[model samples]
Target: MSNIIAIDSDIDRLARKLEHEARLFAARSRNAEAPRSRSWIVVDLEFLFDRSRYEAYSIAEGKDAEEKIRWPFHQVAAVCWMKMEFVRGEPVPMIEGPFVLAAGEMNERAMVSALFATLENNPDAIVTTWGGEARDLAVLRRAAATLDLQLPHQLIDGSPYARERLDLCRATCVQADSVHLPEMAAAVSVPSKPSPSKKIGVLCEAGDWSAVRDQVLADVLTTSVLAVRHLAAHREIECHRADTMTAIADATLSAIPTSGFARKTFAPWARGEKAASQLRGVVYRAAA
Candidate 1:
């Protein structure tokens, strides 16, 4: 296992070196203004499992518990991703998606392959996550290896794209343990996970894909809003810009059908955005 990790590290280094040369050549070839827009892909994944299948072996035995006790998994149930595009001079990025690739609909291998294809096609785009380096990506690596699949090199450690990826948990964590996504959402006053992730496994077992999709979608939206809020709080962008981002996210959530699980899941966020807008208006008038 250590050897595999070492090999992946070596591959990432080589890819980075080649990519750096390519970027230098491109920069010399074109002295144009920076591209008008760029994007970040925010991802969250949920696993599918059945406890009865693992009843024979204790939690410590069935799935490489010795090496990866943090996330021992047999399958990825869903892959949810969002693309936020930032136009130069714009206050906030436009939110494009919180698309779900359900394993039940397309099969696990195919779903993973689709995500890998998306990442490979967008080498320049940043990949954002709450704690992906430790959990989501780790689980994907193991799943890919078991399935004889290949992941995008940019996702590998030490790639030139290392700086292009944002692990929000790493950004905010002060200690060894990561701050949970829901807690961060609460801190930033954004919509949060509608249900515990363990509920995903339960839903999957019951073939409740719609509910699972809605839950994962809510999670990705929460992460996206939290990213903008984090940036503002850290002065990466102005607070007003963060407000714009939050408003767009709320709109995206509102567009979901009222009968769907997300409408109820994000009702609090919708109410909050309305109230916040009113308060911002008063503050602007007072300043004027």
Candidate 2:
């Protein structure tokens, strides 16, 4: 009986491996034939959790204290998504968002549900993220389950869209496990985090919801720029076109009527602009 059980377990493991491989092969074939998605949804989430408690629990369990909590113990502090629409013949994409939901202003379950609704409503847009596949999506899945909410079909089991997720960490990072969003964005000349991640949690703890919102907004903007750069790298758009789209993105942010949050969040990017202007001026003067 023991021998039979061992053999059955081995067979089940092998079957699962084969099924996963089969799905991968099918996904690859479909990707090769499908045209690139013109509509893109770039998303990022910020969570607030009790770090001290998590650390104490992990140490007691003899696990790495630094390991991110996999359970839905964290509250969704903010959820921000930027929608970019690419016209067939346009050089620069149009930006529709930076739509944000904050926990202080809304219930946690409602925030998570809003994200699911966004996915369901924009079924055709390709959802893009930095470490979304492993981090953001994992937390979202657990959060939805805990909240007793039904996930969108796009994120549901066996959904082809779920398999087709564009995780930039995997797509652009040679060392996906080690590379972070700031490093990846820097590599492509995109604006990075406005403030340290540690500060986000600190601000949340102090009930500085606006400050947390600023940090979340900054992250989403960085991710949005990175996504456009990825398209250029893949030859979906021209390099100059990517630059134009980025400038347009900057303009959109500037036009938004917000508090000092927007100004502070975008300051780092302003330095980049100044540097670029200096370089252009040098080239033009030298040519005169």
Candidate 3:
């Protein structure tokens, strides 16, 4: 495990170096106007997962697939971005994506090319992400390398990019005791990722791709919100309730409807129906 991490770090280093020349060209041709403001770019990525019966499209996917058995089988589904800048010295935030750049959506080369193109337009942009330095960026960097794609100059370490890579995930991890992204965000009152509708594979296979896109959008926004709130030194937003536990186990049971219970001798129909409905809803996960 340690060796793999070290090797991945080396890959990221090489990818950054390989992209150096192209990044410069891209930065020069991009819209330089944003540099006038103190702009920071907050980004998040959502990769699609397969069941190993499919092919890996992104380097991140391949790396993930290599470790897992017949599970995981990951691929780059999309990338999302949120831009925050000081306009007239007041903070303003805007969302930029749900950029679906996977191979199935379009030709893989063209999709990746467009992503880099978009990044090129923001030369002086300060890159920020939740856990980008260690995960997102490294994965993206590796993917670009695998494709022989040149990343934007800002992607390669230089003045603004490296110094300004504010990985809120890394910063908050030690403080938050390594709790996951959504938990950390919620504790600080930043809206977290919505409850996932279903497993990614199920949604993808069932042709519910829109759900995946929606999830990515929610995540990126949550990540951006968390970063902005933390930067502003916002207080912990979670309200600690005096009564934390609800006594649903001994609650009132009434009403009647269709019941899934298989009892031939049931006199009290209303009570049975209520128990069945409430019991399933509260105890088990809601039906997908």
Candidate 4:
């Protein structure tokens, strides 16, 4: 474990190498975007990275995000997946597993295998997630490289837009505030994540799998709901055809998304019909 924290050590080299590999894997995909067809899957994952004794000093000195990211050590601690069937009219998420990916050390090969298998099994899905491209899915590619395992066949072919993956974090527009997962859930009145980032490693060390499972599932559900809602809003605003809008509403939405949608559409509609007294008496302008 001490070796992991050493500067320019094997762990550091391997992590950065794997991350670079992940980037290469992404670059191999086709230039296509996910279609807004009211059918999709929402997924989320949680992992550990940049754990070092130096974190305390970094925090004490108020180090910025970029500085923090450069810390040595990277590992995938745990992973989870949630499947959404928009076409089938499933409103709730059906998350399969939040298994411990790192038993003693990070089980890079096995975790990647499971995640790849999940995506491959659902080839027809529009993979929706929050920060997945940069964090979760990308990390899998890196982990696969670290293990020298082949990436899933489907992953190497299509870009984020290729009906393969849809990252909701990049989709929703909230100029009023940045849309973090907790913030998005709060806007919808959904429950926030129970365990914080600092405590996750502690929990993992203590073998609290249930807590890990619950948090991952909560995040997945939140991502699923937000993804569906955001898609519906775009459809409502962008689509001209009534059939398409209705079909989308049926599949991706339970109620219309009001966060950005209302501000964009409803505000305009409300302004159009606002009543004011039509005073007829033009005040005889006293020659001033």
Which candidate gets the maximum TM-score versus the true structure?
Answer: 1
Can you give the TM-score per candidate against the true fold? 0.70, 0.70, 0.54, 0.54
User: Least lDDT summed over 10 consecutive residues: which range in candidate 4?
Assistant: 269-278
Task: Provide the global lDDT of candidate 2 against the true structure.
Answer: 0.70
Model 2 residue 123 lDDT?
Answer: 80
For candidate 2, lDDT tens digit of each residue in 1-288?
Answer: 999999999999999999999999999997677555467788888887857778778889775445776445577888888777776556667676777788889977989898888888888777788877766777788787888998776566533236446777777765545578877666656566766766777787787877777777777777777777678779665435434544545654665447354555444454444456546334221210
Between candidates 2 and 3, the TM-score winner: 2
Clashing pairs in 4: 32-161, 32-162, 33-161, 34-161
lDDT of 4 by residue, 1-288 (tens): 665568558777899999999887776552233333333555666555545645764667774534654313345655655554443233333333322233344464566677677777777666677867656766666677777877655456547654566777766643443467877666654444666646766776576656665566556545655665676677522322223323332332222232232234323322322221122444232221
- Lowest lDDT block of 10, candidate 3: 243-252
Shift in Å, residue 148, candidate 4? 2.2
For model 1, which pairs clash?
Answer: none
Worst 10 residues of 1 by lDDT: 279-288
lDDT of 3 at 281: 44
Indicate whether candidate 1 or candidate 3 has the larger TM-score.
Answer: 1
